[model samples]
Target: MSQKPRRQKHPKPPKNWQPPPDDKGTILVRRELDEYGLNIYEFRVLAHVARRESKAEGCYASQAKMAEVCGISQRTVLQALKTLCQAGILRKEKNEKGRTNIYRLNEGSKWKHPSELEKIRKAEESQEDELLNLI
Candidate 1:
């Protein structure tokens, strides 16, 4: 007796299928995020994560998936995620059962503008210079 082929849990899209137009399906990244001093990889990864967010599940894409979609290396994705999290622009929660992380974009208020970061950098540099002078 011949066995039947198994069915896919999720069917693949047709060869000719195309994504919806920008107006129909859009990812909204606030303009202020641009002033947050994010590098190119960080920006791209953040945008991709935002694109994957949903009202029900939030973003749970693996680093490999993020790298694949963002056209970046997994290590680069990891670094970008770390920077974003440190900057308070994104929050990451561990999924115990899934063994993956869920990402959420924090409110704009939590992010620091580039000018603030520059000020902090200058302050630290001046402190370093003072320490060196004493030494």
Candidate 2:
């Protein structure tokens, strides 16, 4: 007797497909962000920043801290931070006490919002103009 072929297992749909509405409250696991080009590491950092318990004390963490928590190298954390910051998912700030950066979630940031990107571009242009005038 001939044996029948076995079927392959299908992938499961994501439980949480939508991005979190606000960055202040608990953030939804943004699986789509990954699908849209963000890697797992970058998504994790975004989630951590979004779920930060405190903002006054600088809820943002350093690359070293993120590396330790995520079990990745400091270089990887830095790379992820750059990607998230460029994507408008995170805001980076220098810690007053040290050189380490503190990352915060840009709660109002929307990937599809052209105004936001325009604002950033305008700010960069203004800075460039100021520098040129200074020369």
Candidate 1 lDDT by residue in tens digits, 66-86 = 877677788788877876776
Specify the highest-lDDT model's number.
1
Residues 1-135 of candidate 2: C-alpha lDDT, one tens digit per residue: 999996633334357777656766653455545455556677666665666536685555666667666666776677667666766766777788877667666664445343344455456568768989999
TM-score for each predicted model, relative to the true structure: 0.66, 0.52
Candidate 2 TM-score over all chains jointly: 0.52
Q: Name the runs in model 1 displaced over 4 angstroms.
A: 1-29, 115-135
Clashes of each: 0, 0
Clashing pairs in model 1, backbone N/Cα/C closer than 3 A: none
